[model samples]
Target: METRLSLRYTGPAVDEGLMDVYQASANMIAFSEFMVTAVKATFGDAADAKANVAGFGKGSFITDLVFSVGGPAATIFASFTSDHLVTVLQEAFGLWKHLKGSPPTEVNQSGQSVSVTNNTGQIIQVQTDTLNLVFSEKGADSVGRFIKDALNQTGITGVEIASKGEPVAHVAQHEADYFVPVAKESPVSENVVTMALILVAPVFQDGNKWRFSDGTGTSSFSAAIEDQTFIARVNNGERFGKGDVLTVEMRIVQTRTSNKISVERVVLRVLEHREAAQQPSLV
Candidate 1:
């Protein structure tokens, strides 16, 4: 069955300086994408390159490169299905953790504050030591893994069916409307299941206009709205506009023969007003 997984980048709108910082953060995200490609490349099956591939791959062979320019890091999505969904997702989590930081710190003790560094080196101290480590193998499994495993646990046995498809590609330009499947019905045949992942990014424009789309359609917000110093939502959609803030939210969903699981990673970016001074604003 087909399994889909998606990653999204959301944050405040962009100004020239803020764009520079987002570009730096994009490097780390690009590294994570590279790790995903490298892991999938090792699998046999020429079709494997096409099937379990990353968004940046092109040409005949799947390349372990991400080509999209950094612009308010966007979301990412991927999906696949096999009896070994657990094993595959486990490997993915291993690679993701190796590339990203360890799942948010887990506080054995409560009320104790800990220092966590953002993409920027600035260290921020939180009041609680109980960092919600969402993607823990023992705790809450990776969303992708959770979905895949959930389907597998149904106990309805089936044969292993494989298919050859093109390697997934990432969209270069931003879109306002897109569809990402969050869940799916049971598999038709035994041991077979299908799933999909959706990556979404919010875009805002000048005059307080904003929209949310993913290489598909566009949806507008009400008016230019500001929560704190950042623009929250313009019309009604999630995309950010020029002079508005942008936020990227990454979520992974997995579907198994019987169950499903999901996990999310959220990052924020504040687009500085081009006319504003260079001082950093509070988040």
Candidate 2:
């Protein structure tokens, strides 16, 4: 079990640079120290620089380390690396377990997805959270075969399997166009939408109505809530004040008597809530 982990800096702001030369050098040296310590922990200094090897490209901020192990020993080493990396990085990174004789052909990471080509030349797309795993065409068939074989070994066979069926159906049903379709109300109301914004005014209750501004150029909006859930969470032992950041799900209901203004109904579904000190997302 060989675990590989990495981090890279890439952004549109080239002027910002990856890191200062001095800081880059310092980070690389610190990471190299960690690699050496990891190797020593796995092999108890016997392997040293021989079987447990680590190298860094000249003037680069990356390290390529490899450990040769077999059978249960490999599994132990992998578990060690997994835990070690998390402890060292404080759970800010993740590792890939590389089985002997089957190293990945390619590895790429992005803001939303991580793509890896397994040794068998099949692609695996994994989300950062590791909850959604998508295997390529060949990869999916290979996994299905493995699962079928496992089921056979346990005297359970011929089971139906499907991945991504729900998402496919959901998209087809919602996004597909048809001549005659089922009549239904829109999931998103006529003027209802979600907003993530910085509050410019303190949230205060006047009877059943709450008034606040989202710091937008447009005029502020007021909402009336019957459900106590939204305000309960907003209060959070204290009232939400100005400058706090929030993601709100609201409904835009037309006013019967007014044409110029509409009521924004708080749905009580606080998608996100944070203190004023938290920075608003720029991306």
Candidate 3:
């Protein structure tokens, strides 16, 4: 499905309807990344999508891009027409603009309505659907920063993005920085659990996360080694090769800001290590 969107960059530099290829390419990459990231955030990770430039020209240096979805995303939108897709992106940009960069201080969902509290404790109410974009994986803030930062570069005085039949959402050059994602981190929850994890890939370097598979060996994840004794033993010549299963006590931390969700795990104790059966070498 193709949903058309337009982006117009206006400034003295674009007055001649010409832009340096290098700058144009940078802007294009940033914008395209935003589209891909936004789709995944709003529509869930199953979305395999792309925003292709349909047309571009001088005259304020505008470009028309077509959003197309495939794979699981198509199934998710089986009932949604092309018009619905356009509305989807429109809402994404709207919420991105509404947040202006900072993540909500608190969010409460009740039925189809939501209460969002900003940094200053100002409570604003919005529909649940309007927030699927901002309240998704990392929210729209992370994607907004990079795209807006790209526009802030060069001689871009302002930018406007819109889909058909929608009012233009404007971003002044000065306001580009206004979309910077919050750098602060807030802890959500933490817990310790003992499990046997098969090492997928172990980082040999200090202060790095080691990869492992879940106890059921069905999923994989990465965690840091906070067990000093285990690290010391490894440093002293302990072998923890790929496919070795380690029964460990791991502390899992869940953190988030308005931008995204983060989960960090630390191996607090290493209880057992079972090596994968090694083939005998014929001498």
Best by lDDT: 3
- Where model 1 places Cα greater than 4 Å from the true spot, the runs are 1-18, 34-38, 41-259, 262-283
TM-scores of all predicted structures: 0.18, 0.26, 0.55
Residue 229 lDDT in model 3?
A: 91
Position 265, candidate 3: lDDT: 89
Best by TM-score: 3
| Residue pairs that clash (backbone atoms under 3 angstroms), model 3 | 138-259, 138-260
Each candidate: RMSD: 23.2, 22.0, 7.8
lDDT of 1: 0.29
Clashes per candidate, residues 3 or more apart or on different chains: 65, 0, 2
| Worst window of 10 by summed lDDT in candidate 1 | 171-180
Compared with the true structure, what per-residue lDDT tens digits does model 2 show for residues 64-180? 455555555555544554344333232111112221123345767798566656566666565433311111222223322322222232222222111112110011111112111
